[model samples]
Target: MTLPAVPPISFQDIATELRLLPGEGLSFSWDNVKRLLGMSRLHPGPISLSDFLGKTRPWWGLVPVRSNDIVGTTWYSWNQSDGGLAAAVDPYFGNMPITAIMSTVSASGSDSIINFQSDPGFRNNIKAQLLDDNYNVVREVVLTYNAQAGVQWRSATLGGGDTSTCLFIATGIFTINLIKL
Candidate 1:
């Protein structure tokens, strides 16, 4: 036997069924209201400001741009196709020649072997470092580049079979003023 046809429901029908009158703002529980509105899949409650700002993907390296923050001073996380983890930051600090420090740790939460490399052409005066558990310097390298020709950028990578935390800290006078994570 065939089932009887069901009538299509609309906003007015839902509101009426819930006894919600005009100008009578949401007297029913939020869940009930959502259910009546066919929005049951939505989150049950309001999300925190940090979550709204993309902090939920910390492991994925999503950084939320904020007001009153210095330009190009943030390091963002990146994931490589070969199952490696990486982080990068813009090294351009405008014309004043200010020293900017950018750092990031391994996304895996454990010590892992890693390497640091700066963008090929714009690397003068860039000090890249790896720190240990006590924050002591493990390995450090200074990247040099032609001052007038290339843009400033730095990156760090976590490699295979390695079991040491990766912390990258770079201090230098960068050329550009734009933020590129």
Candidate 2:
């Protein structure tokens, strides 16, 4: 006997797995939402911003870019023409000189303090950071790597608001970080 065809999952079902970077006025799913109420034991209350944000860790790392139209707390537009990270999958923040991308696995030691070195010749552009939930920039640090050499970048564990997912967002390009140990 022939087996019946399976229905494709709708976008809504899978959409929960996806989340908009914080601060972009986008919606997100609460994994804790269902689990909190005990699955079927009791009806869950609306996840108040306070409850959800009660105590969380800053999510640090890179996430997928939904659109070239999203312009984070940066000077350049989504379609960064000149100063932006180039198109590259293996590693983000590619060929584009000033664009940002998630940092790729490298020989460089992890846990090494991430610092942002600025190019004085061109202009002053700060690399901003944001939380994973709202993509809201919590802090702005100037890109300065004058005295300090090697790969330049400023580093910090995403704080402010909730700290559940401490993902990092950058202005120059997307950068993924990891602890060396």
Best-performing candidate as measured by TM-score: 2
**Lowest summed-lDDT stretch of 10 residues in model 2?**
103-112
Model 2: runs farther than 4 Å from truth?
1-125, 147-151, 154-181
Steric clashes per prediction: 5, 42
Quality of model 1 by C-alpha lDDT = 0.31
Q: Which ten residues in a row have the lowest lDDT in candidate 1?
A: 53-62
The per-model lDDT (C-alpha) reads: 0.31, 0.29
Residues 1-181 of candidate 1 have per-residue lDDT tens digits of 1111244434444444444568666423354453323233243544221222211111011122111213433332222222222223222322222222233333333221212333323233544444332223355544333334343333333444232322333232221111212
